[model samples]
Target: MCGIVTAISTDNVVPVLLEGLRKLEYRGYDSAGLAVLHEDSLVRVRSAGRVAELATMAASRHLTGNIGIAHTRWATHGEPSERNAHPHVSAGLAVVHNGIIENYEAIRERLTAKGFVFESETDTETIAHLVRDKLNAGQPLLEAVRLTANELEGAYAIGVISEADPFTAVVARKGSPLLLGVGERGIYAASDTSALLQVTRKVVYLEDGDVAELKLTGYRIFRPDGSPVERTVTVSSLSADAVELGQYRHYMQKEIFEQPQALGNTLEMIAGGNTISPQVFGAHAGDVLGATRRVLIIACGTSFHAGLVARYWLESIAGIPCAVEIASEYRYRVSVADPETLVVVISQSGETADTLAALKHAKQLGMDKTLAICNVPESAIVRETALRFITRAGPEIGVASTKAFTTQLAALALLTLALAKINDRLTADDENTYLTALRHLPVAVTKVLELEPEIEQWAQRFASKQHALFLGRGRHWPIAMEGALKLKEISYIHAESYAAGELKHGPLALVDRDMPVIAVAPADELLEKLKSNLQEVRARGGELYVFADAGSEIPESDGVHILHMPEHYGMLSPVLHVIPLQLLSYHAALVKGTDVDKPRNLAKSVTVE
Candidate 1:
């Protein structure tokens, strides 16, 4: 969850490093710092706060150089403090790292025994010591980093610079994301493309275990074995304005409003089409879908909730058996391997560490038929999968996902239709009907976004509450889970979700005047049963907030509050039902005066376990 930006330039790079760190704020960092080679001497500045604070510190200290490395760290091994900040230096070698070094303790002991002192309690410090140790052995900058990387045993994206080698900075990635930025002024390295979009649109996304050495004029890539390699440089499609807040107060709010467009973009290929084609997924999707007898969906967080919804769609619509697994637990537990199962891995960033590991685990189990539904193109998960669907959610900057989740649902829906067609479960009329619904889905979400003003009123009430219980039935049960997640993520509220029928089991006890019970009351077949569950909540003296379909006839009563959706979208209703919940969370966080974009203890991309 940390960020790294390294540059070797012909001019002062403090501004570039600082601005790059600011761009990576969405990745969620508690500490910021930079180390530069000024006059062939290592000069470092750090702050246990925002990039702005680091910028101020750098300015006050007149920190300027032609070559440098910067970091925005989300604490892992150490607490958020100046002493624990990155740009960990040893023997004139500076290193900033993004992922965990699993064997840091043993390495730390070895280094300590060898009389190498550590000033910071970070796994990153071990890398600096190791690299500096290689330098002490008379290795060059690139060789030193490559030798140190060989000793590392966990995921990491690291940037290293040495005062003795002022002309170069070496960056490497193994099980984490790292890229090289090419520009006229300098050569750069960043953990994310967004960080270097300002410096250069052309970037070489380094493969796992690839290392790069950056100089003012050019860069060179090497494999883990120190063999030379070449990576393709591609232009990024993301604009600087794509990440801007624009007129919105926060990125979360902006992303919430962007859902309709995101969904439209994700499903754009199906427009004006009467049939749902398997080719929409990939070139071999037809063969894969035709052969898939069972589906196993793997993901984490919001993507996991999306998978839960997909399970219902895959089974009920396609008449195929489906199961959803939390990626972290799936890999650790032993399970029966089914060769007929189509393993679907979903992630917004596509770099989720657990999900990727789980995919590898499934592969190890001989489940070779793999698919990835993700937002970022060319992500590790996408590359690992045999089939892929790239959601055009653009860039989701908020730590709490909005557009990405909805876009994933859109992609999953397409997959469902494709599979249903492949199995002959979907007739021509059925395909047309679902296609029309899919085309109209954006408009439906736009209408839901219009309910934000009304939802804000509900959020104002929610902000004062310490707990919430969300209830939904059938396919919408997962929507309830997602709503509760959004509330817990941004609003600092403890929220729980249950399938409406499960309320009587134990969650009903949590229902009271102080605990808000939010219900997703769509006009599906389970409407009456969900209403019965709501009645139970009302009987318990619980405050109720309901988002219902317009024609559901769930009237506003003394203790019940209702916001009717503009339409009932049948199987696609979960996609619409989630919009108001996102707004509710965003507004609740806003009313609570919390950080709406970067929630505490959360990062946009979970690159580490």
Candidate 2:
């Protein structure tokens, strides 16, 4: 994922763009660049590291302009290098882009045949040349951008500025996120509102197939066919304090502890008294519930895990036949879909590339009842779908998601209850019980956080291990997968998760004394079966760290350490059990000397494929 910011102002815009880039750097940090229209020409500066290096280079020389575009890149088409960085320029136009261009190779070859030279291996460089070619053919700047956008064949949010039109900037989006911030003197465009939060509170989220022309006065939106479209500017309530970690040592830890409050706020909005608002479900929920014949859940990464859990809840509680698919693979397979099918896409960042693609693909297949469960209120995914439910997890700074994942689960649980109520599947007693359980969740989460000290003590025993295994059954199986993912993502340890019953199939052979086995042993109907699975690992001489419910009998073994968590109500245990896993991974990564906030080769948001 890359970050892009552009400003059209009366004063010089380089300093403002640099500030915006610093705020947006969490999206991507491979390289950074800025291009400004200066003295009837385009001036460009770029570097191959973090934004600090680029700022140093920019400080060495004076590059003055009132309008410009900047980028912090996460390389996709080429390796991270100075030449491969963004702000790709040709003649008078300078461009910065986020997302991939699927047809760049074909377009590059055609341009090469026309005797046009290339500068770098980035797919974005091809856009600059295409715009220059259009201008060379006697097209105006707006027409050139329109033609170039029409020819591109993949996800992108591109910002374009030209010396020929120094007072204006143009932006277009297909799959990635882009927002226009309305201000008094000028307008701002960025990949996310975080970049513009300091300057303006009002924003217009650009829709797919929409083009924005930013000028000194204001910006204009147009359809793909050049038809004017009017949009309302919504004011954002996100403050600067929300993005800060406050007094916490790490963002992951802060986010982990914020779960209880975030869930409480979400529940207050949905289940508060006298509020029977279906609009909270989304604008198209009525149409979707009435016309839907089946349901499909699509997502990637942690959101995929949430969807997997939702599948169980939806099928068992709501009596809806549901199927869950990883968004990356969903589009490749030929599946049955129609106007009656409701496709639900889940993602923390609505700009997740694969999920957005899956959403568009579902729409193309005539699945009009598309709903998105996302954290960002005005993300590209929210704009593309007719229905959306925004998670109240303010802003997750850690590269590995903590609060977002849990908040998504909480939201999905609400959706399940809503479905049950609408379908007459839940009686008054059942509804009251579910709501009561939900209201007590924040307190249960607080009790779960008390297990941190014990988890940290257990983490020390496995800090030197080369590999690990996690096991669970039923709903906890997804939690097992998520636990293993968090460990591998941050600790750089080889970890694999398996269903407790499936351990003997082939994964058990890899277990040894040097390998750590983390078992989720919450007290449930399948507790005895899970205990037998734990015995199998013990027999294999696997170093065991079991997270069990309070008062549960964890058999004494020489190398086994039992972490007794507070007893939680059934179906609410997953939320409690996840706390220990998070603490284990966090402490393990801290001991291993890994960056807890910014993991390697990963960004906070996956806006590009």
Candidate 3:
């Protein structure tokens, strides 16, 4: 995962480049760099830290140019350092690349035989040298870039700039995301639309094997075989203010609090209706769901956790057999495919590499009933699937996801209700009951937000803990896993989650006063079983912090702490129970002085393998 922004403009673009980098820092912040063609020379600058550091260095060097390319890297091939940063330069050509160059070693050997030397340990440097070699062999700038791209293998999105051709920039995409922004004064290219929203909303999403040339006033697109192609320019629907951290101390905190609004926006379609129709997913959703016999869900990271929760709802409510698989592992393994199974892929960005590949693999195995639940409508996964549900969570700028996860759960609940109705498993009264709960979900989440001050108090004690164990039963088991993930992601604490029934098998061995035990104790069928698991922890002298339903009669004792939720929320209890855990991780990170928005060794979107 990385970010790339390049532009050819009539005026100095240093400010635009830096601002774009700042907006894209969530994609990566390991290192940042830029290269500009100015006064018949290529000028490059780089830093080993955040984009703000690069901005400071650019100001000190007084770097200015009308045509430039900038990058914030995620450090795939080499360690994070100034030498391994992007905008790798060679001769008069400079290149900024995203994704891996799989055959770089052989290409590097061939270039070395030709007496070409490399300066960085990144796969991107080979691209600059190859393009420079092509230009030296009498190929024009555009042809040199296209020829160099043909010689390369593996997924990549690249932007090139040359001193010899100072007014134009060349770009190409194979797998990783890249787009062109048609602006009033310039033509721009970036990995994400968020980077160019300030200047222009008109964007052209590039297809695989497509190359483009950008100039001050116009642009051209070409296929890999040199045939000119046409691509539609779409106006982006995202507002620029959505990415800004307004009044909040960190993007993570803002996203965490935005859950109520996000859920309301996502569930707006079923507001006044007494039942959820299958058509809410898409026009063809009725046909697909009616024929589906089983379900298969594929995802990674936070999306994977959402799918795990859906498995519980799908089997229990819809009376359907469902399987949730980790995308990275599922794609490589040889598994039997059932055509009657509906393949559901969930992603926030819709461009996750492993999940997209897994969807393609399922298609190759003759599973054609594909559906995508995602936030971005134009993302590759949504485009490839037959049916889709677009979540209205807006832009999630934090590396650790908050609003996106909650909105996904809300969407999955709708899907469960729709499938249950189609299978005749849901009664009229049952439909009305579930729909009423969905309508009041936003208000329920608002009530949960009021518990933040209490959660922060718990975080003050949690910050000193080095290890933690989280326990839950039934459907809330995945929520416990998510809570553990958030704690380690931002606060850097060691955390583990287990189903309450599995505690006696193994994880109970690590319990002691030094390790805190957190439990999600909802007032449900498994409440008594979960309470017994808590006693096992108390017997081991483990400190206890439990988020229980208001009706639960659990009281705070010497080593036991209890924070009551506003209500039980019935089937939606998992969604309400997760909010306090999110606040706990956020405040703990705040107390520990860790970067909450951009956590270490993590990116907001996983676009690369």
Clashing pairs in 1: none
Cα-based lDDT at residue 141, candidate 3: 90
lDDT of 1 by residue, 40-131 (tens): 99999999989999999998998889999999999998899999998999988899999999999999999999999989889999999999
Q: Write the per-residue lDDT of candidate 2 for residues 1-609, one digit (tens) a residue.
A: 788999988778888899899888766478999998888688899999888888888888877788999999888988999999989998889999988899999999999998889989899999999998998999878778888999999888999998878777999988888889998768999988888887788999888878889998888998888888988799998887887778988888898999999888767774555323356677667656756666799999888888887887888888888889998899889988767777889988888888988898989998878888999887878877888888888888788888888888887887777776677787888777877888888889888898787788777878888999999988888889899999988888889999999989999999889989999888888889998888898899988888888756887569888888777467767777777788899999998888887777888778666
- Give one clash count per candidate, in the order shown: 0, 0, 0
Q: Estimate each model's TM-score.
A: 0.99, 0.94, 0.99
lDDT of each: 0.92, 0.85, 0.92
Candidate 2's C-alpha runs over 4 A off are: 62-64, 270-280, 283-294, 338-341
Clashing pairs in 3: none
For model 3, give the 10-residue run with minimal summed lDDT.
Answer: 20-29
* Clash pairs (backbone) in predicted model 2: none
- Which regions in candidate 3 have their CA more than 4 angstroms from the true location? none
Query: Ten-residue segment with the worst summed lDDT in candidate 1?
Result: 503-512
Against the true structure, candidate 3 has what lDDT? 0.92
Q: Give the TM-score of candidate 1.
A: 0.99
